[model samples]
Target: MTNPIVNLFAFLSLLLFVHCDGSDPAIPEDHRFYETMMVDGRARTYLLNLPPDYYKTNEDLPLVIGLHGTGGNAGQFERDYGLTEKANSAGFIVVYPEGIRSNGVLGVRTWNAGRCCDFAMKNNIDDVLFIRTLIDKLVSTFRVDAKRVYVTGMSNGGMMAYRLACEMPEKIAAIAAVSSTMVVASPCHPSRPVPVLHMHSVLDAKVPYNGGKGIGGYYFPPVDSVLGAWSAANGCAVRDEIRNDDDRFKLTEWLNCTDDVMIQYYLTRDGGHAWPGGQRSGNWGDTPSTVINATDLLWEFFKQFEAQ
Candidate 1:
C-alpha cells in the first residue's frame, strides 16, 4: 500500500510542475502586437502580419508561418528575414511564432524540433499542437486560404518545419526549411504528399552538410539523406535532376512525384549556417549568401503547391 505522506508529496510535486510549466513572461507589444493563446495549458505567442491590401480585398490570402532558430524570437525573425516586406508585396499573411522560452525569459527560446534542442526538448513541449492551434485561429480570424498554408524556418525552426511537414501534411501544403534537417528518429508518415524545398550551404559549420553531431550534441542528418528520404516518401523519380544555377549555387529537383508533388534542394557553395540572401541582423551566425535570395526562391517554390 502507498503511504499517505508519499501520496501527498507526489500530489504537491505534480502541482508545482504544472505551475512552473504554465508560467510564461508577458509578451512585449512592439509595432506588431505579440499575440498569445493557451495551448496545453501554457501560453503560446506569435506575431501576425496582414498584407496591406488585406482590409480592402475579399480575396483569400496565403498564410506563411515562419519559425526562428534556437535563442531567437518572432520579432527578431521578422526583422532578420524581412519576410513581412515580402508578404506586403506578395499579398500574403506571415505569422512568426515564438518558441518556448527557457525559464520564461524573453530571448533564450527553443523549439522541440526533435532530439537536438535545449529546454523545449528537455521539457517535452508540444510545439506541433501549439502551431496547429495557432493556424486554426489565424485561418478563422483572417481571410486565410485553407489550401495555401505554408511553413518555413531557420535552424531549429527549420527542423520544426520538417517535423510539421512529416506530421501535419493535411494542414500544411508545403514547407521550405533553411539551415535545418530531419532529426527525428521515428519514421515519418504524412497523411498526404507534401512538397518540400530545402536550402543549405555546404560550408555550414553549425549543422554540417554531411551528417554529424552539432552544437549541444544535436545529431543532424546530411542534406543528401534528408532530400533522398523526402523524395522517396513523395514517390518522386529516383534519379534527381540537377542544375547549376550559378558558380556558387546548385539546384536539384526530384520530379514526377505522386499528385504532382516535388522535392527541391538548393545548395550554396559557401555561407555557413546562414539564411541565403538574408540581412545580417543579430549574432545568429548567419552569413548571408549573395548567390540567391532565399525569400524570393522559397516563395516561388511554395506557390506551386496547395493543400489537397
Candidate 2:
C-alpha cells in the first residue's frame, strides 16, 4: 500500500495548490466540460473538470460534486468553491450541478435541499432524485469509483448535500458541508452511518453558527443541534472534543462513532457567510477566511473514506 509514486503525486498536488491564490482559483481550460441530462422531464445541467492526464489512465477515479449557493450556477460554484483546480491537481473528477431558476419567492436559482430553500423547496423539486440519477450516469461514463463518491457545497447547496447524505446514504461515501447547516426535516433516516465534515464561520450571518433566521429572513436550525442529531444517529459517544488552532479556527470532533465514521466541524473565527480559504461568493460576497482554505480541508476529509 506504500507507493512512492502515489505519495509523490499527492505532494506535488498539494504544492500546486499552495502556490495558488485563494482569491483566484480558476485555471486554464481544455479538460473542463459541461453536460446536460433529462431528469423528471426537466433538463438538468452540470459542469465537470477532469484531472490532468485523465485520458491516459484506465484507473477509476474518485468523484466530487460541488454545489453552489442560491443565485449561483454551475460555473460560479465551479469557480468560487475552488474545487475544479483541486480536481485537476488531485486527480479526481469534480462536478457542479446547476439549480433551477425559481418562480416562487427569491425568484432565483436554488436547490430544493429539503424544506430550507426557495423556488426548489416551494415547488417540491425532486433535486434528490436528480442528483442520484446524475451520479449514476457520471459513474458509468467516467469509470468513477462508486464507493469513493463525495459531495461538498456552499449555502443552499450545502444543505442539499445534507439531504443527499440523509436520503441516499448508499451512494455517497461522505459529505463536507460549508457555510450551511442541516435543515432537512426531522427523522433523517439514512440506511447506514454517513461521515460528515461541516465547516462554517463564527461570523457567518447568512447561516448563523448558533442558529436562527439568516439571509432573506430564512430560519436555520442551530448548527450544534444538527451535528448532535447526526452524531446520535451514528451512535457516536456523547462526549466531543474541541481544539483551538492559534485562535483562527476551532476544531471539534466526535471521536468514537459507530463504523469508524468521522464526525467533525471546523468553525473559523475569520470570514462570514462565505467559503473559507476561497474567493468571496461573488464580487460583493464576504471575505473568505485566511486561516484555512476550505477546498484543502474538504479534500483531506473526503479522501479518508468510502461508502460503508
Candidate 3:
C-alpha cells in the first residue's frame, strides 16, 4: 500500500532543520526537566523534554527514548541530532540517557552492545534492565502512553535499540537506528515483534553495509544478518525491487505478520557513519560530510506507526 502523505512529500522538497542553543551545544535544553538516575549503583544523567502541550492535553503522550554513541553525552544528542526541535514540534516527550564511564576513562562511554565495549560488554551490565526500570519510573511519574514508547540512537545507541527490541519488545512500539548495526545475541525472540526502521550508508567505513566487522573501535553485527533475524522473528516476507526516489538511497519496507509491524531498510550510496544532518565538531569524529536531515526522516518514519 502506498503512503498518501509520504507520497505527497516525495514530490515536495524535504526540508529538514535543527534548533541549537548558542552556548553549551552539548546541553541541548535551557529549562527542560532532567534527573540523575542511578543504574546498577552508578550515577547516570538523563534529560527529559516534556512537550509544551503536555499540560494542555488530557490524553497521554508518546515517549521517545534516545541513546547517544560512545564518547558522547545527552547534550551531544540534543544538539547534534536536532531532536529538540523535532520533539518540540511533534509534542512528544523525549528522553536522553547518559552513558556511564568506568574508572576515569578519557572520552570513553559505551553500551555493552553484546560484542563491543569492554566495560559494558564484558562486565555483563544489564542495560536492557536499566532502560526498563527507567521507563517504569517515567510512566509512574508522568502520563506516558505505555503502548506508544519508542527508541532511537546512534552507533552504540543504535545497538542498544536492537538489544531493547530483543529484550523488551512488549514495552517498545518501534525503533529507529541510524548508522549502527545490531549487536545483541539472543536465541529467544520478542514476545511481540515491534516495528523497526534501520538507516545506514553503504560507504560507511565504520560499520560496513555488506556486513563485516566494525571499524573505529566498535563491534557490530552484519546488517543483512540482523535484518534476517528480525524477519524470521516477525515472519516478514522479503521484497525485491526496492521503492525509492533516486539512486542516492534504496529503501526496502517489509510487512510482517500484521500490517502494524513494519521494518524498513535504507541503504545510502555514499553516506558515512553519522547521523544525517547532525552537528559537526572536532571532538566527534566521522560526522557526515553531507547535510542530510536524519531528524526529518526519523519523524517521517515514526509518524506512520501507532501503538497497538
**Most accurate candidate by lDDT:** 2
- Over 4 Å off in model 1, which ranges? 1-32, 104-107
Question: Which residue pairs in model 2 clash with each other?
Answer: none
Q: What's the true lDDT of residue 97 in model 3?
A: 78
Clashing pairs in 1: none
Q: Residues 135-223, candidate 3: write the lDDT tens digits.
A: 99889989888888899988778888988888888888889998788877656478877788888887776677777765544455678
Error of 2 at 225 (Å): 0.7
**Tens-digit lDDT track of model 1 for 1-308:** 97888755533322211012222334443324568799999988888888778879899999999998876677767766789899989999998898877773433577888774777888999999999999999889889998999999988888899888888888999999998888764788888889998998888767877889765546788989888888888888644788667779889899899989998888898777778888664543556777878899889989999999
Per-candidate Cα lDDT values, in order, are 0.80, 0.80, 0.71
Q: Name the better of 2 and 3 by lDDT.
A: 2
Model 2: residues with Cα > 4 Å off, grouped in runs? 1-30, 104-107
Poorest 10 consecutive residues of model 3 by lDDT? 13-22
